[model samples]
Target: QGKNKKVIILCSVLAVVVLAVVAYMIFKPEEKLAVSTVEVTKQTINETLDTTGTVSTASEQSFTLMNKVKVKTVNVKEGDVVKAGDVLATFDVSSLETALNEKENNYEKALAAYNKAKNSSSSASGKISSTKKQIAELEKEIETLKAKTSTTKPSSTKSDSGVKVSDDLVKRFIKIAKRFGVEYDEATARRVLTSILSAGSSTSDISGLLDNLGTIAGGSGSFDMSAFAQMSGGSSALINAEMSLVQLKAQLATLELQSNDTYLSVYKTVYENAQSEYQKALTQTNEMKKGWIASEKGLVSEVNIKVGETVETQTVVDGKDVDISSIISSISSGIDVSKMISSFFGSDKVGIKVLNYPLVADISLSKYDVLDVSVNQEVSVKSANNEIHEGRVSYVGAVATSTGSSLDLNSIMSGGGSSSTIPAQVTIEDGDKSFIVGTDVDISIITDTQENALVVPVEAIIIDGSDVYVYAYNKDKSTAVKKKVTLGISNDTYYQVLSGVSEGDVLIKNTSGLEDGAKVKLK
Candidate 1:
């Protein structure tokens, strides 16, 4: 009975204690809590693409040397202003001097040969003149003899037998005598009767001759008897004289022809040959002299060999020696110096210049974000040093590359495939030399903005995908109500409200412990 009474007393005491605790929980007044609220705001938002690139220069030039000779001097340094005809370097000319001497000796030999050929021609011409004068004197003597012989002869037409007078011959003699002007017309009749008895022609033949006399007399009008006698008497003497003159003239002509063939023709050949040889020698000498002068003038810009360095006259292209002056001219004039120097020296110079200010940056963007980037767009860059610069986007690569692969969620979340990009040129309106090229930077592009925006804290709004809701506190600060809200542009900290929320409303921010229409205390 005592045990039972103890258990019963314990149970009654526990019940009274629980009832007192429940009465205290149910009857206690709610305490007032201070809470902060934000009104819904409307604003603008922006989307942009970001990329990076490096800067480079505009122009450059390089110089190289041609021949392998000692470096006599380097007239121009890297930054020197070299004109077209500037004296750059010089080489020893002792070898060219020896070549010039040999050419001069050859020219002298040609001149001597030409002089010898000229003298031989003058001697032959004098001999030909003297021979022609002798022939002219002989022809004059023959003419005088022919005149005397023709005057002494009178009708002396006998054969080589030299038979004398017959009556027929006497008659012909009288005719010849009259025709030869040896007798007058009256003397002719007496000479004819005398010739008839002397030549012993019959009377009948004499009568025939008299009958034909009229026919023969027809040609007697212009006849000169003395000239005919002279012609008959001197015919052989005149022929002999003409033959002698012809022989002398032929000898003189032959001598002149031989002189022309031997001296004029041969000497002309020799003179032409000598002139050609002398011209060749003079050309070689002039070349050597010019080469020496060029070496002295320091026109050769560079030489690879030392003072005792041995080098062959190497054929640059199929037996052509290197022309040092042409190379120097090409280099000084900015011609094809690279190819010329390369052919001579077997190497080329690479020249590059960095003209514009260059800035390099590494940037990453999403495929959807690539469209907003382009060349020459203004960008706000924040450097690693926390310094900010205003620049224009100069370039954006069309392809995307990986940043890195990592096991972290943030790294995996950033991993992506190929993303299209636009390169933009950004000109820094203010030149800032402190920003070094190749520096990585953070960029944000402002796509949109709004003034006097009615905004609320992002945390105060509840978002289930696209559906958004907010817990509005009632006037009593207890019993908060859930209200659906229309939203607008948003940033990291604030959300723009388009509708369903107004100014001065106390919206619930931490709705984790609250239910729809549930009693809520603001703190």
Candidate 2:
């Protein structure tokens, strides 16, 4: 009976304690924890593509000797600015010049002889030779006539036939001499024909002469002889032998005159032609030796040679007809496939080791990313030291680059396939030699911008697994309610709300210890 009574008292006391605790909670609510909130508002958001690049030199060049060479002069020092064609160095060419000089005189002599030989056309020499033969024959004919007159009987002109001076022969003689470009008259023709017969003129020449004379005399068979009797005859024959002798003497005088005047005139012309050719060769040599030529405009950064050096060279011999290689090198020797740099052939070793100031960054981007990048696009670069540089895009490559040392954005988070890149060049403003070449730096490209977007503090957006939500004040402001939101681009400080949120809703900025549909009070 006493145990039952104790149990009933204990149960009754627990009910009274529970009623007291309930009465205190109903009378005094828990104070709302103070927290800060922000109203959703319209603002601007920038969408940027971030990248990186290495600083590098713009251009470079190198100098070298062509072979086992001798240096004649060093014309430039390091760090000198020079224009194209400026002498950077020279090779010793004195021995070559001396050898060339020795050969030059001989070359000129041979050249003059060849040109003179060519200039005195075959026709001119042939005419001179024929004239000499004609003169000798005229002299022989006169001698023959003298001997015959002393041994044989005298005769009238009609009986004289040994030396032809008739109308037919005179016409024939004139045609033969004139056809060969020799100036002739009737006296000259008579002398030449008698001379021709004395030297034994060919039968073909005689026939050709007769045929041509027939055309000139208006007859086809042969020219009339009597009609041409002494058209310029000096004297009639007392006897046939005297007539032949007198004509022979006259022919000798005409030939003798032509031999002295016409033959010597051709000889003088040939001599003058040789001298003129020599003079022209000397003039051309002078013009060709005006010194070396320049190829481009730039600073002369190096000089590789000095004066008084010996170099071996192969000699050219025209007589033996040997092909000798040239020792001198061209400007293009220093500029070709081996020393070239571009998208086609990687890059060249810099002639100058260090380059800075007005820096250029060689940035690589994905193929898709580079399509939007163009020449002269604005860029902002952040160095490893957190220094920001503003610049313009200089070049955007069309072709893709092969795999290299850079880490792709996809590779940082998830596994990716093999990737290619397009290279770009950016020129930083006022670099002032502060940036070192070949060092990597961060870069950002402002690709897009959104204006007047419904935005909220980045801290206000909460991620619940795959979904994003924001907490907002209820209508009475007694508690906070959860509002889901869709997001666009986000800058450093704000989130651009695309949907699921409004521009006027009050948002919870400080979300510590906050949950969706959780009670909250704005501070």
Candidate 3:
């Protein structure tokens, strides 16, 4: 009985211990899921884009000949470095010299012709004036004869048949009788001359007065010429006056023809045409004398002619000839020649090609990063041999590339497609001849930057449709709460936090499977 009592007591103690352990296991609270978190901190975020590109000449000047001339010597070849005032090539100027001499002679001839034409015009004006004077003198001589005739008239002091012959009376009778072609007697002729001489009319009026005197001889009536001459000066005086009148009329006709100006105009036109042709030849000769010289310091990108080749401002493209003279002239006009010397080789000089120095890189940007690039932006270039160069964005293509193809370094490095890249230009500040043109190089452009800005790892940010958010870890509650964020520029590893997060704010570093408002433990 004593043994059974001790065994029962032991069994009861064992059962109570087992029941307590089971109760504790069933009542324990659940532990939270552990997560890695990060603190939002102020940091500098440099937004950059990297790509590959080619080094090429930024501004190439093509040296072309405006006239066909034989090359005398080629001082430089392709890839030659040249300085301002360096002679690029020499021409056989024997042709140029001959042309210049011809042009000079032509100009002198043109000038002489112009002067001769001017003198001829002056001489013509003088001839016209002298002819007019001669006509006037002849008219005066005719008037003088009329006066002599009046003085010698037999009926000077009286009228025939007792008719009153007043000075004014005789003049009126003569004028009316002549207009109607009436015959007059010798006494009437004598009276008419007496009246005209008394009036002392001008030479211009005397010619008309003499023409009226024909009335005396108009009819079949017996008005003897001898009787009329006796009343006037004499037959000889009348004949001399009539001859002078005929000579005056002939001279007036000649003067009228000269005033038409057709002859003088022909000479003037010839002079102007000669002058124009001379000027054209002079311009051509002057340019030919210049030969070829470097206008600015640069590398010779091409040398198209041999030592004896005759070159012209023409070139063949796709088997068709084209005039590149105008195009070349247009390019030359844009160069700033202020830094270059005016002459080389004892004459004013210019070249067929003028290449401004320094190097540039041509790169492409994709639609993903095109908006982030612009002119004057900082850039870094790297060669295949790992040489780094500093540069700036000089040109951004305003239109899409026509080929729709480009080498996008960003896409290439990231193993992405390059179909959307647009062309861009970078001026390598310290680039030199060491860089082979058309060779590929790596390029990185500083597209954006932020200083002392709140940022978080790109992985920490969550994309929910159009909204971007992050899980904020609450230190007091030991829980993660969903907080929306406004992001600014982003780099490879982090994003500039614009809003909804502050410096020192804790965030869930990896939100891959984290739930909103879920319990968590700090890592």
Candidate 4:
């Protein structure tokens, strides 16, 4: 009976404790939840496309030697940084000086021979004077003949083959015909030229003539030269006069040559040949004396030959001729032809490779990522060593390369097949020679950016279906107020609030236990 009484008292104590706890939860003052808050403020946000790339030199140039000479000094070694106008190597001038002396002596001998021939020809002045008088008489006779023909025949200006072609129009027709690879003899030329000129410059007429000409030049078509000639309307009188004039002009040219001392041309040719030889030797000697000069600033990537080595000439011999006029013109136009001349002239080919700076990183992007990348976009590059550098997007290729499969955009997006990639490049703005080429690097391209943007932490955002809101802390009511926000571009940690939030607005950092209109206290 005592044990039962004790058990009852213990149960009564437990009931009293449970009743007290329930009363306290139901009747005590409402507890305010402790919450951490953040203030929205203006900040810069950058949306980037992270990728991998390889370090590469922006440009590479190769220099070569163009002479067979003994190298006296080697001024640069591989991996040396050099500047424009720096002498890369020197050559022994002993052999060149001897050659230059020999050239000067030959020139002097040729000049003496030319002067002697010229003096001897001066003694024939009497014969030259007679020839000049004869030429003048012939010119007068040709003029009289032309006058007589013009008076006798009013149509003397037209062709005798019934073709009416002005000399200028004939010239123009010949030019156009040449473009189509067609030509005609003297007589046939006149008729065809006259027909084309008579036809107007309308599209149909010109195109038809071109088509017919193309047929004559081995193209596909049935073109009849006789039919083309039949279209000419010219008189015979004018052609006869023109033929007579041509004969007279030919005779006059012979007389004029005689009157000007014909032997003078022969001697002049010899003298000019000597002069050309001398000039060529001089140009080569001067260049040899200068050795090899750096055309522009670059890092030397190769040094193929050592000092004291004789590089043999590889240029064309007398049997093989090369057109060097264009090469000379290239040099005159400020193009770096030091290396080009070496290759062209078959000179002793010692290549000096140069890597030009501001460095660039080569990377490839998937088809979708390429759309967001463009030239001039800001970028950040990180090397394996944790070194960071600023850069800009320098190039984005338009074409995509397949990776074992071809798929359309819709199919690729829906996971139908493998995607293609496009090549891209970034120019490191602050890059220099210190940046190693062919190294791997990490890059982030800032595809989008916003400055002075109203932003809040992503933790403060509350997303429900299509609605985006944030729990803003109300200082007046000591509660959390739900406010809708229009979002813009976002970075990793913050969202750019385009609307519904102002700078300096307080927001709940996390909405885990917070509800709209819930009482809250700053933690």
Candidate 5:
């Protein structure tokens, strides 16, 4: 009976245990991850940056006139395409003629002054150089005289010696004459004395003139020849003094003549100064009139002036103000680029704009992309119509520029806070023969290229601090295996796997919640 009861209990326990196992099996399930996968392939991987840019052929052509003048006739209007050297308008030169005439008048005036400054040919013809030297010496002497005058005022013209015609006496007389605005050489002074002696008929005329000659000695003090006569003691003494007076009068005449002759040199100097002034005025005016006119094969973009319109002393044209002073110095081409019309009679007042064709594609790139780009690197441009043109990098900016497209580094890289870019240009091969002018297109610059490289989707790559990894799917284990990787070049879509990942490896595309060993079901 006991053995039979134990057997029943064991059977009941076995059944309960079986029921518990079945319940647990029904409720509990194995964990798995739903993931996407990409095949690692070996192919040529091209590292490229995608960017947008405007396709432009050439810059706008401008034509303008710089000077202020009247328009005589209008030869062309806007939208008229003309060849180089074509006359588009004529100007009224009346104002220009007047200006030239004024300048010429100034020049003539200077010449007239210069001519007048010429020392009288008859007066100082042979003594021109000597006369100039003499004048300079006199100027120094006059300065010395001024210094002397500052110390003392001359009280009298009397020499240390009595009124005798000696060297000292003559010197004193000359000093006195200079004070009175008369001077003479020694030879001339002696001739004057001899002439005075010859002219005097008697002492009576000499005596008569003595009272009138009170101021003749020219110092602060007056000389009275009458006093000399009184000193002579009697009639014979008076006669002697009268004879000396005649000699003095002759010397004074000679001194007066010498002093008057020096003025011719001063006139010559004044004329020379005037001549220089006139020449400068003439040169400046003539240079301003030698205006530059524009000539090129271009269309007449716009016309600002009408026939017979007098150019304002200052006027605004094409949003720019024109002025005479500034125009004279900086306008070497003689064209104010803002305005299209020039003015001058018999001179062409029209300006023709210049334009050229551009044979290159201009693009802008982000800083990272530009770092790998260099001049002469190969580039390929694709048009909207899928037309491709091969070219090379003609230029690459060394520094970044703000004039880049709105979409930049931020668009490609998450957490990329920068949008700064660098500008680049590419010259199309075959002279743009396959492309139309002003066509918008996509440009790809080849930064790095690899052949038969293992490439995988960029999404497959994962990052942990100081560790780069990818969730590589192992077919045998039916699991995603996190494998550290070394990477090379990359583009928008894929990365060139250098190592730690191999060709034919299935890479997990969705790395969310993935770790080193995770069970994954790839669909």
Candidate 6:
């Protein structure tokens, strides 16, 4: 019985010990977690706007030629320096020479035609003047005869049979008789004859007076019988003289009309022909001076054409063909070929090389941040080589890039894809020629800076909307108290403390699972 009892006691003791161990394992407080913490510190903080861009050369050039003719001689090679009046190349002039010769012949022909037309016009003008004078003289002579026939009266001798007029008397009497009532016989006839002799009547007025006289003589009227008989006999004679004058006047008028018509025709034709010829000659001369064969003076740096090489007419510039002669002459002179090329091609001096720098971290910055970014701010450029370079903020696009849809392969292929970030230009300031234009580079532009500023590790601060909170650890590390803080500029790993947390305050570096009022133990 004693031995059994002792064994029971040993078992009981083992059960109690086992129970105590289990209780200790189940109820022991959790060992305090050893958390890393940082103390608020005073330091300088720099806020930067980071992006990427490329580098490019400042100057470049290109050239083009205009002449399509076979190259005869190339005077200069590429990169040759030439001066003004240098011949760069030459084209076969055989064709141009032939054309010029043909133009010269045409010009000579035109000139001859012009001279002949001019002479004919001048001769016609002289004949017109002579004909006009002859007409005037004939008119004057007719007027003189008319005046004599009008006033002269015939002498009559009285015989057994009334007044016996002599033939001369009869002729004179007939001339006067013809005037009779038609020409105012004695009184008006004498006045009209005197007016004509005195040049008192205009040619038109004189002709009208003659017509009136003829009408009067031809009409019947009362007068002295013998006188009337004598007048009647003279009437036929005066009428004949007047009719002859009329015929002569009509002939003179016809001659004047014919001469005028001939003169006008000749003058117009000749003048027109001469003008046309002169214009043609002038045009030909100008063309010869300005055409392909015309020699020019200029510097030519590059000559693409070789001897006997056929080339198409190249547009050297936007709308102007290359002046073949000028180019050839320029090439002969050692001028800068690059400048010539640039001028010919109408290209920008600097060639842009676009590089694809893939986007890393893009975020919409607030309007307040946008205003801080400006041109020429020094920044850090991170290249593909993992090298950092100094850069400047070259541009900041005003408009934001649009982004709302999923990736569109078509848009990407067509280079029409959109994004949310604003476009900006950064120029690499530090780097050798190894940096190419349009190369994508990472850039960080310093937007703000503060010296000896109150700062804390970025991990220490918790951002919730606009409100920033930090967990402040007690000196004993028994608890972490949540404290609100106002912040300033922030860099990659640190934040500038504007208010709240001060130096010497221990701040929690990691706040992943911490709550606003969570209790904590320090290890």
For residues 1-523, write the lDDT of model 1, one tens digit per residue.
9999999999999999999999999998765444455554444443334344342222222222222322343344332333334443344434544533443454455456546545644665778778867876876776675666557663332222333335554556457546435553544444433333233334454444433432223322122233222222233445345434534554454345335443333334333443443445345344323322222111122333344433344322311133322443344366764454345322221111111333445455545555655666656666546676776555567765554442333344566432333333444433244444445446655444556666888788789898898888886647668888887666667777778777777787777766676665555
Leading candidate by TM-score: 4
- Between 2 and 3, whose lDDT is larger? 3
4 against 5, candidate with superior lDDT: 4
| RMSD in Å for model 6 | 24.0
TM-score for each model: 0.36, 0.42, 0.39, 0.48, 0.39, 0.38
As a whole number from 0 to 100, the lDDT of residue 415 in candidate 5 is: 54
Q: CA shift at 453, candidate 3, in angstroms?
A: 2.8
List, residue by residue over 401-475, the lDDT tens digit for candidate 5: 664346554554765444666778876653333444556577788888999899888899886788888988888
Residues 1-523 of candidate 4: C-alpha lDDT, one tens digit per residue:
9999999999999999999999999999767889999999998998889888898887876655535557788888887888888888787877877655655665676677667656645644445566556556755664665566556744434333453555654555565455444565556666655544433223344344444443223311122234334334333333333333333333333333323443354345445555665676686577668877776777787888778987655433221122222433344367764444334323335446777766789998876788899999999988556778899999999898765675556456678677667988999877655567888788999988899999888899888899999998999989999999999987779889999989889999878877889999888
Candidate 5 TM-score, C-alpha based: 0.39
- Candidate 2 vs candidate 4, TM-score winner: 4
Once fitted onto the true fold, the runs of candidate 5 whose alpha carbons sit more than 4 angstroms away are: 1-29, 48-135, 140-371, 378-393, 396-446
lDDT of 6 by residue, 1-523 (tens): 9999999999999999999999999999755435578888888788986544444433232222223334566556543444334444555543544433433454454445445545644565566556656656655765675566568863222121332223433344346445443233454444333323232223444345344433323322122213222222233334334434443443333333333433233333333433443344354334323422212222222344566766554222321232322432344367653355345533211111112221122223333456888777777766667787776666677886665574534446657645344555655555443444446556677988899999999888898998898998765646668999998888889999989988888888878777654556654
Task: Judge candidate 6 at residue 404 and give its lDDT.
Answer: 58
Candidate 3 TM-score to native: 0.39
Q: What ranges in model 2 sit over 4 Å off?
A: 1-18, 31-34, 57-357, 404-417
Ranking by TM-score: 4, 2, 5, 3, 6, 1
TM-score of 1: 0.36
Give me the runs in candidate 1 sitting further than 4 Å from their true place.
1-19, 29-36, 41-367, 373-378, 392-420, 428-434, 518-523
Q: In terms of lDDT, which candidate is strongest?
A: 4
Cα-lDDT of candidate 4 = 0.66
lDDT of 2 by residue, 1-523 (tens): 9999999999999999999999998997766756688889997777666777898656544542222244556565654555555655555443434544534553455455434434543444446556556646655664576566567674333221476656676666666445334445787667545544433444355555455443323211122333223222221222222333333333333333233333333333333433443344344233224322234433343443445545333332221111100100111244332121111111222112223245688988875687668887778887656888898788888888766556776444456555567888888764533455678877777666789988888888898798999888775856778877888887667889989878788887888887565666666
- The true-versus-predicted C-alpha distance at residue 108 of model 2, in Å, is 18
Clashing pairs in 5: 64-339, 93-345, 113-271, 114-271, 117-267, 117-268, 118-268
| Order of models, best lDDT first | 4, 3, 5, 2, 6, 1
